[model samples]
Target: MTLRTIVVDDSIIFRKVMRDALSAIPGVEVVDIARDGSSAVDKIVAAKPDLVTLDIEMPGLNGLEVLEELDLRGIQTNVIVVSAHTSRGAEVTTQALSMGALDFILKPDNDNAGANLAQLKSELARLLKMVKAQPQLSMVSSSPAKSETLSAPIVARAPVRTTKTTSVPRPVECNLENLKTPKFPHLCHAIFIGISTGGPKALASVIPKLPATFTIPIVIVQHMPPLFTATMAKSLDNTSALNVVEATHGMPLAGGGVYIAPGGKQLGVKADARGNVIAVVTDDPPIKSCKPSVDYMMSSVPSSIARNSLAVIMTGMGDDGRDGVSYLRQNGCTVWAQSAESCTVYGMPRQIIENGLADFAFDLDDLPNLLSQLAYRAGGYCPVPPIPSTTAPMMATN
Candidate 1:
């Protein structure tokens, strides 16, 4: 199926260049072009393209203004920001993301415009695929038969309960004393996690259950836009017993603390002169179209923790964590994937599982118990056996 797109920019030359770049991508067709944000809104309301490429610095109701208008009008078209490569541009682009833009591309300068344009073409194609495969829209809007055909596998794999329970206990508050040290020898210095799709809800369920006595620092790469990650961190902080914040460069990784990579930056763990682990945030080129790519984080952890790391790949839309999981496993760091039945989208975990990269395949509900067991073992407090296969049989529904 063809993905209809619209280009909105004030610069005539840039618009033409973007048009050509998008046209080169298969299954994508540009349906309209607008000179500025106001006209872009008009064209969007009329043409209703599946995607939009919006320039940030346009005159007469800038890119962000257009997004605000679209939101007010309840338009849900995927919008990608095309902005100049400057600190101010980055800040504005980040703000646009908070306002609900899906992604951003640094505008190419005249010197390397061709190469950058080609990169944009690749990025646009990737965006198209993600938009088309978005399960929420497809499942809610399509006819029952069509939705069944599209979502049968996912529905069939969902978990079942013997009895529905409406009441859930409030999560305990995180504190150092609450962290329980384990009896087993220390095997890992850091914990790495990658999640996507239904990650927000899943994280809310799991993170709060983590003990504040957990000694190793935790880092996460959840597939999300800037503003969304910020909100997610805040939500986690409120629910979790431990402190949860968006990661910043040079910050120490405190025990029982969780650091979420900020949007628009790739997060890496680096050692300081003191040999302490610190967070590094950079505007380096994205890995797999995600600033805080799971593979990027997983690949770096083994080095940062020096063979004493644990990598976990969870629900997501693609195989971004597959290679990193392999790297961690080969290097003697433990690696795990969320089992298919418990996932909202099983793409990342499925890749790791199919490749035999996972040391443990766990259900989401069982994760808190697993972590508690791991902690007990690490602190020489208890003897927990190796994690067993937690994959449940797929449930079928009419």
Candidate 2:
């Protein structure tokens, strides 16, 4: 089956290059090209293509404006955003995903045009195939308003006392006064989460669901570029009870907060002078073509909480979290995967689910309650302990 596609960019060269590149992917047909947003909208409507490669900085309407126009007009097409590797572009691209784009590709700097072009081809091919395989992806991307849920076995994974989760709640502004001490005296010490494509919106849905009383520190590895991760952290922080921030080296992990792995770097944790676990951000090499690989971060985590911590693999388009889930599971940690129906891209979670690595699989909406249950499992929170200075020797507390 040929996937009819359109390449929309202001640059004549990129449009031609993209057309040539996508044409090489098996079962893909470059149906047309649009050099601007207005033209893009018209070409998209006329061609009725299955996919669109849209540049974020196009003249006239720009990629984001095109998306909004498409949404207003109710035009349905799988949009793969093409963005420059910048903090601003990253911000807009994430907004596009939340607005309904399938995914995005970063434009490498001009110094390595040849290498960047080669990378783009492989990325496009992989994403196009994902769209083809998942019938529900069509509904989600084309009409951001509708949710075509698949009948997942939510009961299989829900904790014994969990009730049915009917809908995702709207986001609320954060309040830090409700913040507790870093040490989680409860049974669940920490939460490790990983996500990729369709992550911005998915995180918004899941994170805001955690109530203010929820006090476990959460570490997240969302596959994103450098500036993009920071933007995401701020976005999640604004709407969540958890005080979310981008991970920085030496920052101690504490309860009631969320840390986003900085883009382009590996994020992990280590024991500080006081034996308290602090953030470890590094320039480690990429794993499986991804910097800040889920496996890398997950491995850095100590196995002490394997019995009490919760590890989650959410929406994504690849097997990034597979080995990480394995590592956590081997240490006796309970692992959860977002159900296929609830995921924008099911690749990461599907990997663990198929391998018997995930201890449970639940819809994205169901996870918040499960995590809340995990947070308070020991029955109550540990009384607030004295705060220590940064340079003060840390003591082990969970």
Candidate 3:
């Protein structure tokens, strides 16, 4: 299934560079190129290509306007935004994600053109592969679940009813009997989420939906570069009932406060002398090619809190959280994965699911309710219902 692609950029140089990069990626056919947003829109509507690599800044009609125009026309083709790492670029990119761009790539901000192009090709190749995996998805239509939440104010809802988990796929090495099915939600102390790729959009879907009465410290490692994560944190803060901020070094983790690992730095937690777990931002090298790697943050979980922690692996492009999840599971932490059907890129959650590390698999829309229930359970005022269990046995996939 070759992806019919178009490169839309005002700069002739970048247009050529993108075309060349796409041409190198297998199964990507650069069917056309547009020099500006107007021509891009015209070509897109006419050709109906499978994908478009769009530049955020353009003369006449910008990328955002093009997206708006596409939405007005009801075109749902794939769109991967190409942006610089500047403050303005980051701001618009975050907006683009919320406005339904599939994903984004940072343009070269350094003088190393060769290295930059190489990095661009690698990232583009990965995103393209993710796009190919779900042919039916588009930037405009990737998250149909968000419409309801977007239209209506997020209100507390009834607990999710029991659903048998027998349909979930199990990896061959995991033994269901050996798995610890303890009632860990009642003991949960903190929530750590690892997300990437479509994280901004996915987070927008889940975070804002969390109940206002909920009061658990939530930490997130959304794979993003510098400036972008900060912008994303601010964007999420505006809509979320909880206070959301970009984590800084030595900032104490506060209840009901949501902390996002800053882009370009590794974020982890360490307990101070008073036993207060605080966010630690480090200039550590990238792990699994992710500076703010989910594994890095999850590995830093204080042992005392490990058993009482709940780790969530959401949409992403790699297995950054797998090792960390394994560590948490060993420490008696509960792990939940976003259902593949609800994920924009199912890589991160798929890793945990395939490894048999996940205790529960839920759709994105189900997560807010599940978390609300867990928080309610921890409060001990009401008897929280148990998570749905597998009624019928599942065979491990070979």
Candidate 4:
């Protein structure tokens, strides 16, 4: 099946380049192109393609305005916002995601376009394949994730026949109450997480559910560019009970706060002279083609804060968190993975689950309660239920 797509950008050069780049993909086809927001919307309504590459700074009406129009008119379209790497661009991209754009790509500035566009092409193709294979990620209404505890059974789609990456397959749904959680040497001192793709919406969904009395320090590695992470942290801070801030070098880890690893930099942990663990922000080379890599953050914890860690791997594009999770497991740290149905991409956690590295697996909406039970001790009623080895995995009816 051809991955039908449209490019909506005002720049003639970018329009041509993006069209050519997408056309070069084996299963993708550029269905149409629009130079302005109004025309983009009109053509989108007409073509109704599988995906749209929208520019945030288009003339007549901005990209966000076009999304507003689409929402008002009830036109169902999957949007991928192509935005600049500036602070303003990050702010708008956040708004776009909240407004229902599935994700955004960082368009390089004029000086680095030649080198960076190649990377952009690869990312665009990867996302297109992801969106095509998973219809759940391309929701036309509401945010990607909802801020609710696990109440409804997951509605699965026709099983996507993927090339089996491992011999031992994970059951579709394991009963968490019956599954044995990993034992730790001490109470979970901090929460370390890695997420991508649908994370902005996921964070918004999960953070509000965390109570103010919860005191576990949370550190997140969300794959993004320099200023984007800061903007995302600020957005989450406004609605959350805990204080959320962008991570800075030398900042000591503290309870009752959330720290986002600054984008375009690798964030690691280290012990200070007084033996207190602190954030180490650096411009180290990208791991698995990603700065702020999950592996980078997870690896840092094993030495400084391993035994008291509660590591989580969530939605993302690749196995970036695998090695780090392995490290956490080897060091006696507890780890949890988000269930596949609740994930936008299901790559990171899928790798850990398939490898039998995760201690517990929970749905995305159930994140807050899981955190409460483990970190806050607020859900003590369900704390560490007896594991039932004879139980069968529950299947999700499509």
Winner by lDDT:
3
Among these predictions, the greatest TM-score belongs to: 3
lDDT tens readout by residue for model 3, 90-146 = 999999998888899888765888777888899899887778765336533233222
Regions more than 4 Å wrong, model 4 = 71-76, 110-120, 132-186, 273-275, 378-398
A best-first ranking of the candidates according to their lDDT comes to: 3, 4, 2, 1
Clash counts for all predictions: 15, 3, 0, 0
Put down candidate 2 lDDT per residue, 139-210, tens digits, no spaces.
Answer: 332333222222332221111111122231222342322221122223665778989988888888889889
Between candidates 1 and 4, which one is better according to lDDT? 4
Off by over 4 Å in 1: 112-119, 129-191, 195-216, 221-251, 256-293, 299-318, 326-350, 353-398
lDDT per residue for candidate 1 within 1-398, as digits (tens), equals 66688999999989998999889988778999999989999999888787889998988999989999999998877787887766567557656764666666667775687887887777677655666665433222222121111221121111111112112122234232222232222665677899876676578778889877766667999876666577678778887888999998879876678899887777766555444667767666666666777766665542435366677888777767665666666667777778766775667776766555666778889888787677666662221222224422111121
Question: What TM-score, computed on C-alpha atoms, does each candidate reach?
Answer: 0.55, 0.78, 0.81, 0.78
Task: Give the higher-lDDT candidate: 1 or 3.
Answer: 3
Which residue pairs in model 2 clash with each other? 184-398, 274-393, 274-394
Better of 3 and 4 by TM-score: 3
How well does candidate 1 match the true structure in TM-score terms? 0.55
